[model samples]
Target chain A: MKRARIRWHILVFLTPAVLVYTAVMMFPLFNTLRLALYTRIDQERVFVGLDNFRTLFFDPIWADQFWNALGNNFWFFVIHMLVQNPIGIALAALLSHPRLRFAVLYRSAIFIPTILSFVIVGFAWKLILSPIWGIAPDMLDWIGLKSLYAPWLGKEEYALTTLALVSVWQFVGIPMMLIYAALITIPDEILEAGEVDGITGLSAFWKIKLPLILPSIGIISILTFVGNFNAFDLIYAAQGALAGPDYSTDILGTFMYRTFFGFQLQLGDPHMGSAIASGMFIVILIGVCIYLFGIQTRMRRYQM
Target chain B: MNKARANPYNTAAMHGALILYTLIALFPVFVIIINSFKDRRSIFREPLALPNSESFSLIGYETVFTQGDFFLYFQNSMIVTVASLFFVLLFGAMAAFALAEYRFKGNLLMGLYLALGIMIPIRIGTVAILDMMVATGLVNTLWALILVYTAQGLPLAIFILSEFMRQVSDDLKNAARIDGLSEYAIFLKLVLPLVRPAMATVAVFNMIPIWNDLWFPLILAPAEETKTLTLGSQVFIGQFVTDWNAVLSALSMAILPVLTLYVIFSRQLIRGITSGAVK
Candidate 1:
């Protein structure tokens, strides 16, 4: 009887969170997946199991857009992995130096962009790179690299990559901070041991600190993967829902938003929108699973 | 430590790289803010120049204030963000406390269930979420955004708070229990105060995303009265794109509040993140 009374309090504590999370998050997510498996016909819901999936994959019109978006999404992820993570790691490594002057100032300033809304970053970059505004051209001329100036955000070949770089600029702070945190936790004794063994300076970083921080790197990688795939606001704010320069910048998020919400001439299609979202879900799940099972489990966490 | 003394060149190079990156990060924001104070022609003629008495103008800010429902949007954003933060911290702490303090059946399962949102982006359910909101007549309401944000924030809140709750000394809680304090009182008086730093960390983490979120606000609360600062700024800038002064000022207005808050709380925010509350 006493134990039963005790258990009641547990339910009391858990109820509100469980109720809210389920109603708003889990239920809607599962419902979306369910919606994807069905389609509307004659203003009534109709079961169309895997037909949406088949149309998305095999049908030429849908297939082209889906593949384009998916490919662009992968490139977006690749840029973050290759560009953002390395720069972030490098910045963290530099900032973590014990005698570095103005380390806090540098860290704080670099992270300033991260806290601003995507709207600000997107529009700010847009204005800076605007051909009419002449900032980019002027800056290039100042540096005597005027020949390199182009309206990158307006060019089909360069729009996606340019936006990806902008995103990297805003977000590199995350990995930098995370890695810096990890780097600071390393026992000074370990580095001293490496120093005593004639492994100091860059060599000490490479041979000792680098290996110790691999787990942090892995965490940063997965975060980049998840964040990149789900990214919408930057592209939407900068490129519009059409994700143009001829849809070159259309990642899954923008693609799904356009498909669901409708834009210009296109009418909304919730079923197909859910299908795209479901596709994103699978992609993110695969990436996360690979990290969790394939990478995280294998990486040996040091006791220190 | 001696590496600094031994390698002056290396130290200089590190500082050089960091300084260059910091400048790059701040350049655009600085440009926007400065030009917002300048007249339109001068903004284009000398975008990099600081606003002097000759260039200074408040025309753009006047336009933003008069033309758009900017204050309403700010209020809506504040309401949604603050209300959501309250529920997320309260309910999340309660749930986290239950998991940390009790060894109940399905505890791990419940914890994992709550944690699913941490890895899975909640935006996947936009289609259904929109439909449900419409069904419940919540579309275009601040409550819709608040509820969605609360759900979105809870998983991470529980995850971080649970870690902190586990570190709260058990003896204190037991002694409180012996004094005839109920579980709720023990939670309110004992555990919650101990986990305040973690709560602040969770608040800092959730606050930015909620404040700056465009997706939910755009989708659920796009009505004129219900728009958030982010969506409002986006729409305002879109309409006034060619009006350079107004555009720059609108962008500046949006940036200033978040910038000020970030500057003030940056120490606590950095400490929270570096304290490994996330990992």
Candidate 2:
């Protein structure tokens, strides 16, 4: 009777949150996946299982845009993996050095961008790089490389890469903070032990600290993958929903937005939007599951 | 201690790389903020210099205040962020406490279901959610942002709160229960106070993204009366594209408040993250 009473209280307390989260999140999520299976017919939806997917994959018009965005999304993730994580890790390493000067100031300054709204950062960069303003050219001129300045955001070849770099600039502090936290968790005695073994400085960081923080690095990697694949705001803010200079900067997030909400000539397509959302959900889930089951297990096996 | 000559090379290298990167990270903000206080000619001529007596001007800020509803947008963001933070923490903590303290049937399953949202972005439900909002006529209102952010924030809120709530002293709670206090009274008076620190941590975590988000504001509540600071500034900056003064000022108006808050709370914020409040 006492045990049952305890269980009843737990049920009563938990019921509301579970119910609300379920009613709002679970039902809609499943409904989205379900909606993706069907197509609109005369503004009347018809259940066409897997036909949307078939069209998305095999149809030429949809296929070209779909594959282009997918490939760009992959490249986006790759750039972040190559650029953001390494820079973040390097910064974290520097900040974590013992008795570092003005560490807090450096950290807060570096992290201000991460806290900034994407709208602010995106527009700030757009204005700073504007040729009319000549801020970019002037700065390059100061460094004796004014010739290097170009309308990067306006060029098809450089637009996506430039935007990706801007994103890296804004959010590098996330992985920096995460890895810094992980680094602080490492016992100082371990590092001292490495010193006793004649391994110090750069060598010790590689042979000792790197191994200890692999799990954290793994966590940051998966988070980056999920985040980059779902990115839209910066692009949308910097280059509107059409993601111009000729859709060269288009990724899945902006594409999904444009598809869902008509931009200029396009009509809003709820069914196709849901299909695109379903695709994003699958991609994120695959990355997360791989982290949870695959990478994490390996991380533990190699744990110090 | 006397080996300055020995280690000077690496130390110089470390300082060089760090200071360079820090400048790269912060120079844009520096440029915008400085230029926001300068005449257009001065801004174009000297982007790097601090505003001296001759250079300092409020032209940009004058335009920002006169042309845009800066205060109203700030108020909307505050209302939405604060309101969502309240419901998310209260409901989330209560639910987290129960899940952590009890070993009921399907407890693990319930936890995993809540965990699902942590991986999946809530924006995926935009189609149905927008449909419901439109049907209910809640779009273009602050309440829509409140509800969407509540739903969006609750999952991680629950996850983080649950992790913290589990560590609350069972002995203290049991003693309170033995004193003939009802569960509701015990929770309201005792457990709530105890978990305030953890809730603060979760609040900081939830606060940043909600304040910084641009998508939901653009999609759900882009009315003149309802635009958030983010969306409002984005639109304002876009309109003033040719007016560098207005654009820089608008950007400063958005960034300065957040920067001030960050510098004030930097330590607490970092502490909150490293406190294992979520873990």
User: Considering every candidate listed, which one attains the maximal TM-score?
Assistant: 1
- Interface RMSD, per-candidate values to 1 decimal: 0.8, 1.9
Off by over 4 Å in 2: A1-8, A301-304, B1-6
TM-score of chain A of each: 0.98, 0.96
Candidate 1 residue-wise lDDT at A164: 98
Model 2, position B211, has a per-residue lDDT of 89
**DockQ for the candidates, in order:** 0.89, 0.62
Model 2 lDDT, residue A123, Cα:
88
RMSD of each: 1.1, 2.1
Relative to the real complex, the DockQ score for model 2 comes to 0.62
Clashes found in each candidate (C-alpha, N, C closer than 3 A): 0, 0
Q: List the residue pairs that clash in candidate 2.
A: none
Candidate 1 lDDT over residue span A54-159, tens digit each:
9998899999999999999999999999999999999999999887889999999999999999999999999999998999999999989999989999999999
